[model samples]
Target: MESHIAFGYSFQAVGKGSCSTWGTGHFSTFDNYLYDFSGTCNYIFATVCDEITPDFNIQFRRGQNKKITRIIIELGPSVITVENVGIIGMRRMRTSSALKGPVKIVPPKADVGH
Candidate 1:
């Protein structure tokens, strides 16, 4: 199966742009700058790094075959890891005295019979 990401302006207040990557490492930046990068390395897709601790960070790793192997997302109090094989692993962030977690959300299953 192939994975494609479509971008949009969902959070109009927080952000106002779109960036997407699809098929063989083709990427379209937020400003509509398009490019192709087929590197097999860990890449920081997006992040707010000026603060002491960022609220969110999105990253992905490509395998030697030049395909995305996995994606790791750190969103506030949760960490989500998604593998290309369709398995998603999730966890929480440990605070000074407690832990903050996310509510479980599952993706829809693919219709393989089709």
Candidate 2:
């Protein structure tokens, strides 16, 4: 079965934090989320990072096989809060190009009548 489970309790942080100590001008973190070519948020990040760059943003790519990942961003802020705590994948990608096409189903032959 596909796992639709979103790991753990979810929370949000909207101020400076531990990572904020990193500087007044340079960092951000996002979990379980990504920015598209149009620079829009299509999904929510599973995790978050403290703001350090005065005013900036965060981006992260999830993996296909990773269930858990711990990040310690030092170049951003000194403050950080871990809500919705749980395992997360980062920057996942396809392993094979052969699996990108349509699939064919085979049918079983009818049993011979006695």
Positional deviation of 74 in candidate 2, in angstroms? 6.4
Model 2 clashing-pair count: 28
Put down candidate 1 lDDT per residue, 63-103, tens digits, no spaces.
78766677777777777776654435464333342111221
Whole-model lDDT, model 1: 0.55
TM-score per candidate, in order? 0.60, 0.20
26-79 per-residue lDDT for model 2 (tens digits): 222223322222222222232322423332222222223321122222222332
Once fitted onto the true fold, the runs of candidate 2 whose alpha carbons sit more than 4 angstroms away are: 1-6, 14-52, 55-61, 66-76, 79-114
Give per-residue lDDT, candidate 1, residue 75: 70
TM-score leader: 1
Query: Could you give me the TM-score of model 2 versus the true structure?
Result: 0.20
Output the number of the lDDT-best candidate: 1
Query: In each prediction, how many residue pairs overlap at the backbone (N, C-alpha, C within less than 3 A)?
Result: 0, 28
Q: How does residue 6 of candidate 1 score in lDDT?
A: 39
